[model samples]
Target: MDLDNLIVMANRIGLFFAAQPDRDEAMAGIAEHVKKFWEPRMRSQILAAIGTEAGAGLSEIVAAALTTHRAMLQPA
Candidate 1:
């Protein structure tokens, strides 16, 4: 998985989740229903999108990562 592509995808997923009425619940649903099913590399890519920098808290990044993981699992 390309890290940059994954980040872009994750950021998009984050934006989508952020737009929802219940952000935290959406994040949790994603973590529970999606992250577990993702390929290891895809999971890593999503997590990488949530940077470890001080400005990007781990929890927030994890949320984005999980959301992205879930989105990737969905069929078109």
Candidate 2:
């Protein structure tokens, strides 16, 4: 998938989890959703984008979730 599309999807997930009362849980929820539903290649591409200018488009919560749960999102 394209990086922009990935960002949109991740941000959408973040939007859903943002309603959670606990910030940590929200981030974790975002990470878990990505980890569970996205394929390894898609996850890898998103991870790479997270370090680049394209990543700036990501929502604050999505960026935080990507940063905080990076290890878990990495492909084996």
Candidate 3:
């Protein structure tokens, strides 16, 4: 929705990836992979975070939720 929201979302997603020591590389290495199916706006938000590396802790979860939100917003 906005920058704050985007940051929170990204941070959450980051955390999830960070949690999984095994998958951390796969997750971090393939950051944009998750947003591939997202709408333009969600894609934009995730892209904005691509450079920041701000998605840690709760941010990863938020990002995951944003994906769900994007899916919900998309036309059926």
User: Candidate 3 has what TM-score?
Assistant: 0.45
Each candidate: RMSD to true structure?
Answer: 6.7, 0.7, 8.1
Per-prediction TM-score, please?
A: 0.50, 0.95, 0.45
Scored by lDDT, the top model is 2
List model 2 lDDT by residue over 17-70, tens digit each: 999999999999999999999999999998888868978899988888989999
TM-score of 1: 0.50
- Candidate 1 lDDT, tens digit per residue, 17-47? 5566886666765565435555666765555
- How big is the positional error of residue 14 in model 2, measured in Å on the Cα after superposition? 0.5
lDDT: the better of candidates 1 and 2: 2
Worst 10 residues of 2 by lDDT: 47-56
Candidate number of the best TM-score: 2
Q: 21-61, model 3: which lDDT tens digit per residue? A: 66536353335544554456765655545336543433444
Candidate lDDT values, in order = 0.54, 0.92, 0.51
Candidate 1 vs candidate 2: the TM-score winner is 2
| lDDT value, residue 50 of candidate 2 | 80
Pairs that collide in candidate 1 are none
RMSD of 2: 0.7
- Scanning candidate 3 in windows of ten residues, the lowest lDDT window is 55-64
